[model samples]
Target: MGPKLPPARFVLKSFMAESGLEPRLLPHLRVTNAVEGKVDFELDITKDHTNRLKILHGGTIASMVDLGGSLAVASKGLFSTGVSTDLNVTYLSGGGKIGDKIQATATCDKSRCQYKTSIDYRLTGNEVGMTLAYTSVVFKNSKGELAARGSHTKYVSKAWQAQSEAFTLPEDADIAAEE
Candidate 1:
């Protein structure tokens, strides 16, 4: 059994509140699903998120990249998702207009267990980049048309390593705090 971490949605929503940038830009973004090293979000394309062309702004897509990566890292129990060391975004379509809904899925590309035995020195050993997370995001419109895709690399070693306490779950982790 691994450590008992807070629910993924809890970590993500709390991040939306605590992150200085997220509260200002994506105050209303909804976390639809969250799991270890992954998260999904849905948001309406508001005029505020558009450019002079009335299309979803490239800046907005980039911000989503950052947000998605951070949320994914937080889902791993690193509530304080570390600084973005790199970010790359590619615009595909218009993304959406002021009334369209878009969904974004963010996922971390690597994990300790997944690479545990691959290296002579394990990531679990807290060696170099023990908590570096390379995350990717895909954005799609309500019709399931691809809008944009992005990648983010963040250095989260501090927060990840600081989480020394582990709690075994009493049961499956899907249950909630309240209705």
Candidate 2:
């Protein structure tokens, strides 16, 4: 074998530290696994994540879906920080309660290059080893039942490279030439 590859958890942890957003926006989320084009995330539903009904809030679930898909794309050893172009979620159940474990797995369905790279991702969730939701992917409650499913589309920037001035032209070149 060649040099041993780092475990997914370590790679994700390092990436999250560099990301500088997880600790703020998703303090409850944790990366359990990550590999090329795929990532798994888990969150323990707590009182803070619930709504008046004491079930997981829809907004929280949506955030998890978005993060899951984005991380899956990032796990490809590419730059993160892509902006979401579109995100859609469909709630199927209301089973996530406080103290329940929720898990999501995101998979990159397609990646394409344009002026900017675009990634399509699917997310799924499971709770207690049972399917919870499936859309682009799924979400599950602690008992392993579906909660929500979602899909996310993002435009990823290519690795930045410095451009020399000599090879560049100003945006107002046409007007300058006319003058």
Candidate 3:
């Protein structure tokens, strides 16, 4: 068997609590798998997520693509604060219908970067998996047929606040003291 996967609900809950993303932004998404440089997510298509035609909304799919890519980058355990410099999605088939399960997997490409060749080569296979690269996310329907594909280029911030520890306020901080 493959590596044991964490509970999807727990992963999502922890990610939201740490990332501070509003629950409403990704109410139906669940993290099915998360490992260094890779992440997978799933969503059950419900009436609430459908368009007037009773099919999953394109916007919803696009949002999932973005979320998948971001989470994949976060799996590296390096930086969490980043902005998508470019996102492109191509719909390969009709959107899912209500009651359908849509699955998405995001994989970060470690070799794609503008850095010097020698340094970039060295960065490969590093424990941290840090690299300035693009993330590719693929969405599939319940039957495992391709639904959409997305490419996201993210600029991970190197600022101090982007460190993982920054997500948690110090116990002695003013906010904690006030509380």
Task: Find the candidate with the highest TM-score and give its number.
Answer: 1
lDDT of 3 at 155: 72
Model 2, residue 70: C-alpha shift (Å) = 1.2
The TM-score-based order of candidates, best leading, equals 1, 3, 2
TM-score, cand. 2: 0.64
Prediction RMSDs, each to the true structure: 5.5, 14.6, 7.4
Judge candidate 3 at residue 9 and give its lDDT: 31
Better of 2 and 3 by TM-score: 3
Winner on lDDT (1 vs 3): 1
Candidate 2, run of 10 with poorest lDDT: 126-135
Q: Model 1 — TM-score against the truth? A: 0.77
Candidate rank order under lDDT? 1, 3, 2
Q: Give the clashing residue pairs of candidate 3, or none.
A: none
Which lDDT value does model 2 have at 4?
10
TM-score of each: 0.77, 0.64, 0.71
lDDT (Cα, tens digit) per residue for candidate 2, span 1-179: 11111333443444456766655556657666555566777887888788999988898878777777656654443333256667888998874888888888777666332121123223332110011111255787777878788887765433211211111222442211000
